[model samples]
Target: MVRGLTVLCWAVATPGLLWAAVRLLGVERGPLVQLLAFTPYVAGWSLLPVALSLALRRWWPAGVAAVAAVALIAVVAPRAFGGGSPAGGGGPTLRVLTANLLAGAGDAPTLVRLVRERQVDVLAVQEFTPEAAARLDASGLAELMPHRRLNPVAGTEGSGLYSRFPLTATGVRENPGGFTQAYGTLTAPGAAPATVESVHPAAPYSLGQLRAWERDLDAQPRATPGGPIRILAGDFNATLDHAPLRRLIASGYRDAADATGAGLAGTWGPYLPDQRHSSDRVPAIRRMAARITGDRIPPVTIDHVLVDRRVGVRDVSVLRLPGSDHRPVYAELALPRAELGG
Candidate 1:
């Protein structure tokens, strides 16, 4: 009985310990890349191993499980309570909204409505399609956000950046993952120029795409502290828990969601992986049905608004967009004054 109890305790406890190590040491690879997206959920479950080991009087496993639980919690807890930067009272405020259109299947009218109602100053879209672009413009997005740099194409390869302010030095760059990202220098009146991009690094949808995913994230442009403010917003396809994303954020940028303590909120997939980006054509009823049944599958935070560390993050919220698998992340940021040259 003691041997059986030891086996049971070790079974659960060992996996938690492994998860904690890989997460902290940034050693995740292949399928683990995809799996680590659920680290927040795993963090909560880590406690179970500790309890089991302790209750079974398995002293060795108990110590190990306790360490794992503490480590995982330490990794996840801060995101729930980070020090939010104060809004720059008199500085220019840029309200950013980012979403993945799921290959243009996200509702055009609803996306437009979000921009209008939220008074969004900049909008970054991923998985953008030419058809979706036309639909959005026709639905009055062009009027709301007149300035734009769009790379709308067929399928999920497109991205776009739309702003109310003028855009300069705009272009679309294709990442190693074959996704085109739209970028531009946004010059809002009375504020410093911001180089913003609609970022969509490759998702590690399969083990085959894992390397591509890492390369894409590694290639993201870093912010220079004394340079023009940079904001990278869209479906990053990575969460704060992922190592590559964390490394990129460490490079002079702060995730608006993390800065505002909304980091743990899920933005993608309460849907199955296969259904997460399915066509937007599925009727509203069916979509709701999937979500209701998918309550057991916890979503992950992959969409983000990463601003220059110097920028102030006033607020962050994850909002529902009915037709898309991903939720839109809206962040209100205060850009530094023009005098503070980079």
Candidate 2:
């Protein structure tokens, strides 16, 4: 009877454990609330499974182990194959990259290196400084990409937009707190007009600040003079599972990265390298290292490139760039010509 009961408890908790793991992967959607939603799942799988195994020390414990393994496997599968290339047919695809440069953090060289390697078509940078901007310009990135919009905030942590196509200044608006959010009209070679907003909003860590940021985003007008093919990129400082993120989605924006299934790609919290650290700190730093290596919160993803639902994403990636705590997020979106009403 004791052994049977243990097996039952194990079976009951297995699904929850699986859910917790999956929740952990998807937790960044809501940094404060939904992020904590999987706490029960972690407790059940991490502690309860071992406790049940010990209590029910018997032949059936083997069955419990099997169930646990199956549960874990099920949770990780979505992140693995979720963002593959579309099966049969698709339209012209454009690669978009978004990065929070951490005020340049001595990472200009690496950023330049990544740009060349990735062949990024459209680049959105947050926390940009004039010096860093000059460094990128010196690297000849501005010449290579050509089309650009640089916010004149003149700080280490400002925002800017760059593209491989021609650009015309559409509008520029500063939030009430003075952060510059620039919107530009990009004329890609053959695609429809894309209204890209390079925004660097204040981190809405508190309830009051979050509400303000939410209000500010709501005020930004949608794409004009063409169909509504919009791209909101930069360091949003809010997670998707959060209320603000929910609002954006419900209001018709889709996370190009997450929607294309790049849920496991975490892009924040000190993944960069420095010469000062000893090898011991490196070895002992499992949790931080895991967040970087594991690519999930515990590393947060305050940086994003979200598109309206009308667009289709072909590929999404997080570039492991040096200098910033956050990685550069990349998305390949296929905006069908037919979808535009010109």
Candidate 3:
């Protein structure tokens, strides 16, 4: 029993250690390395091995696991607890909400409720299909958000932006792989007009997709400090762990969730339970598996709201939407009076 347990301890600890090393070494190059970039974001799972090692009284293995956990925490903790931009002098607050409709599977009623309840000033939707656009129009969203820009595509690459404030469609960026991002300027009362973009980069599921994803991210206009404030929000399909996103953030923009210490929150997964597994036995086991593995397939923070550092992020929150695989991310931002020369 002791020897078997020792083997098990090594089995778990080795992978954790290897992951930690890879993460710290920044080994991103090939397809596998690119996939490994996402590992640190889910590093919370490392604690499972740590807990097991401690339970088995395996100090050395426990130490190794602990190191792995510590490494992950070191990478992620800053975003969760780091201080954000200081409060700007009194100015108009802009409430923005971003959601990925999962190819228009988002619930119309829920979306309307969120817009009304949150008093959202700016709304951005990804995967905005024509059907979803029609539903949103019928749901009285237009009444609340009078100004709008809708780029309804045939498939999941569609995107849209709606605003209570006046919105002017600026341009649309189309990337390889059919991914589309919509851009607009929102003119809010008593505040300088800010550029807002609804973005949806392609998923990095393959080398081709990964390169396209990087290109899309790179194509996103960088925010200039002390310049016009820009809000980029939607399903980036890449996390802070991705070099492209990290570089983007380092270039004078800040993720709302990270700015507000909500960076650890997951916005994807726990999708409407699979009907095939709806039976009690299968569903329960699936749920158990999800719990055990952190639902790698279902749970991650791929959706985000990124704003210029000059924009004060007051708060950030996530809400589950019916029929969608992703949660809506809302951020309350305040534009500084000085930025607009108010």
Candidate 4:
């Protein structure tokens, strides 16, 4: 009977331990498995083996407990070391819009219409191609957004900024080809000079890329323009679940949507196996719905608009936009009266 109980515990514990080990060793992929690095799931998995050993009054439980504790520690160590800031604080009011154009999936007109309707103050676009830029220009975007910045000219990881206020192109890098990872000055009519950083870190195909991007964001220089507000916006390609992202939170950047309880706005690959695809001529719309509903696996939030603590964000939302694999994130930031000098 004792042997049987021990076998039962081993049966449950071994697989959990192996899975945890694999993730820790970087043997697995995807955002879901990454959580084993810090989530509480590891503790529950390690407990059964410990209980079995304790029942027999053996030294094995100690071993089990030590291993389990280590796994838990690896997953949560970043946070313990002060990796993220408080939920939401600091910064003046700044409205923001972020979207990935998906290299012109034939939804430009609709997307332009949405931006005009929403009256988005600052717009950031990734994967923006020159053709899309032409389309946007034809749509009179230049009139609405007088100031603009473009990087990578027109391709993947390419970024651009369009704002109602005039943009002073400072700190432009030519090899990353004039893509100012840091750009934009606020021209919101008597508001402070806010600096906006538009970043699209290199996606992690391997552990190295992932780690580099993490450090890049963590160490990304901060620019203060005599303004109480700072804004960071773009396709991080990383989620809140990761260790590096926690550090961004620690740095006092406010995640607008989560702060306002806007729900998990996952912007990535769309289409579930069970999902029925529409025959509509526009693939962008069909795909956008697939992304929201998570027709395949669960949705993940990759794109984001993070604001500084002094800014009070009233609302944040996901909007369906044409010509992109990802939807646009819109946020309404409320400026403090003192910051506004009102």
Candidate with top TM-score is 1
Give candidate 1's whole-model lDDT.
Answer: 0.87
Query: Cα RMSD (Å) between model 2 and the true structure?
Result: 7.0
**Alpha carbon lDDT at 342, candidate 3:** 21
Residue-wise lDDT of candidate 1 within 103-166, one digit each (tens)? 7888888889999999999999998988889999999999999999999987789999999999
Give the lDDT ranking, best first: 1, 3, 2, 4
Q: On a 0 to 100 scale, what is the lDDT of residue 296 in model 4?
A: 47
Against the true structure, candidate 3 reaches a TM-score of: 0.83
**Residues 62-100, model 2: lDDT tens digits:** 455555545554544454356444321165566787877
Candidate 2 global TM-score: 0.69
lDDT for each residue of candidate 4 in 42-123, tens digit (9 for 90 to 100): 5445666676666665455446555765675465344223223232324344678887666544366766777788887788
The candidate with the higher TM-score, 3 or 4, is 3
Question: How many residue pairs clash per model?
Answer: 2, 6, 1, 19
What lDDT is obtained when candidate 4 is compared to the true structure? 0.60
**Segments in model 3 whose C-alpha atoms lie over 4 Å from true places:** 1-10, 29-42, 47-66, 87-90, 274-298, 338-342
Give a tens-digit lDDT track for model 3, residues 238-295.
7777777877888888899988898878887566453233222222443454466554
What residue runs in model 2 are displaced by over 4 Å at the alpha carbon? Answer: 1-89, 206-208, 217-226, 272-297, 338-342
Give the winner by lDDT: 1
> Which candidate model has the greater lDDT, 2 or 3?
3
